[model samples]
Target: MDSKIPQIIRKSFIKEIIKKHSNIKVQSGVIDLLSECTTVSVSYISTICNAICNRKGKKAIGDEEVIEVLSKMDNEFILNMFEELRK
Candidate 1:
């Protein structure tokens, strides 16, 4: 499906979503809404954890793992991610 945010923008948006909503419950809710709003469940919260885990170089990742990856993302990426939301 087409995305509201292009692929180039999406990478950073994913990073932004992950970082902004570190708490699992909050993150899950945000992801759900964003997925609904954008029609982008392919980027949903559970999809992220599963995708990360399914990566060749990556091991299984749980909620904490997801949080860690999201937390370590750069602030600049996050800022851009938020900025796009205003658009």
Candidate 2:
């Protein structure tokens, strides 16, 4: 998946998330680095999702696949966070 993640997530959205969650001010440079890291992480997950889909002979990527990947990676904290977000 060589697709651009910029279309899906942007720096402004990241800034908004930070602002919403924290009172500490963040520098533009740090925000830029975070944005880049977020992009890379999302891309990596997307790649894994694609591979999982291929192995399953599936044509789509959904939350189940994402949760499965996270579970396999033992990301219980993130999974729990997401589960809370759903409520």
Candidate 3:
């Protein structure tokens, strides 16, 4: 991950996805799709705040954990839902 990737930008990206989808049922599919495109996981996304703040490596995160975190932050549930679709 590049240090240049700003937190606000990441948050905005998530917000945009949520705005477009807004459905929790869609997370699994979205995640799968994303997995095919990148090495990011549900745990990475779920702990995004902590990872960003501490600059954690991608290898340390897991997909299921990210899903769990997303579940709690439904304010942008679509971002989480997209996780499943990624596959």
lDDT (CA) for every model shown?
0.56, 0.84, 0.55
**Candidate 1, which segments miss by more than 4 Å at Cα?**
1-43, 56-61, 69-87
lDDT of 2 by residue, 1-87 (tens): 446566346778988899999999999888889888877877888899999999999999988888888888898998999788878
The TM-score values for the models, in the order shown, are 0.25, 0.81, 0.29
Error of 3 at 76 (Å): 5.5
lDDT of 2: 0.84
Which RMSD values do the candidates have, in order? 13.9, 3.7, 12.1
Model 2, residue 59: C-alpha shift (Å): 0.3
Judged by whole-model lDDT over C-alpha atoms, candidate 1 comes out at 0.56
Instruction: Report the alpha-carbon TM-score of model 1 versus the true structure.
Output: 0.25
Best by TM-score: 2
Candidate 1 has its poorest 10 consecutive residues by lDDT at 37-46
Give candidate 3's total backbone clashes: 29
Q: 1 or 3, which is superior by lDDT? A: 1
- Cα distance off (Å), candidate 2, residue 86: 3.9
Ranking by lDDT: 2, 1, 3
Give the per-residue lDDT digits (tens) of candidate 3, residues 9-64.
Answer: 55456556776878644464564455443435534564574664356544555554
Model 3 local distance difference test score: 0.55
